[model samples]
Target: MTDPFAPLPRPRSDLTEPPDAPQALTGGSGVLQGRMLLQVSPARVGLLRPQLDAGRSGLVLCGPNALQQARRLRREEQFSGPLLVDPAVYEVRAASEEEPFPNACEDTFAFDDPLAVSLAEQRAMGVTAPMTPTGYLHAEDSDALKAAVRRVAALDDPQVVFAAPVDVGWLREEDSVRQLIACLRLLAGPKALMLGGQMDPLARHPRAVDHLRRIVAEVPGAALLRTDLAAFGALAAGASFTAFGAGSRLRHIVAPGEKAKTSKNFSTSPHVLFPELMHFFLGKTLADRFAGADGPVCECASCEGARTLDSFASNAGDRQARAASHNVAVLMQWLRTLTAFAPGLARQRWWHERCRTAVDRYPLLNAQLQQPNGFKVPPQLKRWALAAPASEAALPRADAKDYRSP
Candidate 1:
């Protein structure tokens, strides 16, 4: 019988580290220059202090206490990198009329109001880049999106970023996505942040994914927020930057009116990133798979020479903290590797090749682990792997108005 706990073979090319020849790109906000941002709740601020202090990543504060957290990080931790507070106004707009608000949601509304009020509050909190407040973009309404874009364009401060939180399913409507792209183009600067409400990881439908690709490709400085690993696909499609949440709930937007279950049957394991596979699994699931045996090893700064893939299984707070840190470190390495290449075709090709390799290795990894059906590649990842490198000449221009909605 094959040793299911044995380490899987490493890929021929190392995709985690930067190459020696190419010079890393600089200038502009790190977020706009292709660096990944880490979004975390106030309670988890200290968890990523190492990365924050080292300037390896930027931070986006979410949750009700985000303002207070930002103030503390600046006053106490002295984190000087790009920092922003998510106003989370989308939650209010997403809530169904009769649905009761969660504690977090209620607290968010107590501070963050819509439009100008939220911007003012963020400014007072000393947010490095204050995002213009926006409401949820439902499939049927383009007015809210249009107004949000215009509001950002009219703002005198260039540091303001346009935030567009939208229904993930709305991407299926070709016209709606086009409208979004058009509104984004109207912004004074190339600083637009897209939030996919209830997207989980990403849109699975082919058309929806394609539409997302179009938005990322067409928008000059488009970045994805709360995207999780799907941020890789956005980066592949030429996004300026992406942010992944530190925990499962923060990883994706919760749909309006969706209430948390009160059930106690849920597993307490923190989700750990399997870098080679480019997917996250419950730590317990990983422990079970590698029971009594060694599994893949991570060389990320957090895991180097000590933590193995299965070691993150414990549900203890400290273990969860380490798991989160390890995940960020691994993602930062990948970002460095991706950004090392010249932008456009070179970067896209490298990402596609990496995805392809991950896809091909899935079967072998599963077979070796003695679980033939396990480790399926996500549909979006498969799409990226199979996608041809986008031609620079064919890409949409920043000012293209052909798809603009009336």
Candidate 2:
């Protein structure tokens, strides 16, 4: 029995490419292979331009006006990277028998037609590599899953990646995940993008986290889109790429018909990523925590010398932009560290060890803050640390040869 997590021998030349190299957008090449993409709303494009221009991967995702946004990014910001316009087809009712959800389809381009038409729409938006138009699949809907598979398998264009936006509930059932994986295996190309609707952080959903690990591990070229910190775990599990949302709204797929909850007193706060903890905290909350005690200090290029992590909480007008930049810098730093290792068991073990150390550090941080329960270790961190590497037998035999980590 082979240890799937063990490092596979590779030529030195194969491992020397810089971590931030641009992904190839052509046939049989994974567009996002081994890359970390920052999904930013149009408003934050200016804040993130330096990083994007420096070759940090980026994704500009919009609804119906994708072309306008992409054009603005290129013309105004001079941004260079892949852009995706979400068809938002998931908002439309997939079937007449489906329960009525609030229809938000008007904001999205009509994708109820066919995959080729959807690709054509994206091409017009200047997307050289487009994703197939897929609807949100409800849990246990085998018919819908099969239909999506057929739609993707019918496409001969290797540049078009299969996209599936599914209810997160599918991750709760092993059989459901297996069925989805089998369907993805049947696609004409190995690359696929997965979006989970209304998915909480993997830390909160232990079952989903485990199942997600399995999905990425078995499916070569699988990428998790519009996700949060959990994207790192998926990358470690063999995902070709992962995208981090710039804001809360972009972090997870909002279920169709769901409205944003609001109140007069509601205010949005910027969240800062604490690389040491591998979790995000509200800027103010982090400021409060480090007020009287020593806390982890970030040394990323953005905050190396003068700025402290707590400075993100300052009432400065540019606070959000600063925080967002700092977050990307820290994340890129982490990515570079991970990619430094050879891409197999070596990288996997390095990540597992990182998670384990983070889990252990929570207690020390709590003690330092004089609050016993102040820092609860994220459950997903513990899971990542303890998860056993998948055995060779657990891999989908058909796509087993395609399972190379980026």
TM-score each candidate: 0.79, 0.79
Q: Indicate the residue-level lDDT of 35 in model 2.
A: 71
Each model's number of backbone clashes?
0, 0
Q: Give the best candidate by lDDT.
A: 1
Query: What TM-score does candidate 2 reach?
Result: 0.79
> What's the CA RMSD for each of the models?
13.9, 9.8
lDDT of 1 at 271: 77
Candidate lDDT scores, in order, read 0.65, 0.63
Model 1: residue 273 alpha-carbon error in angstroms: 0.4
lDDT of 1: 0.65
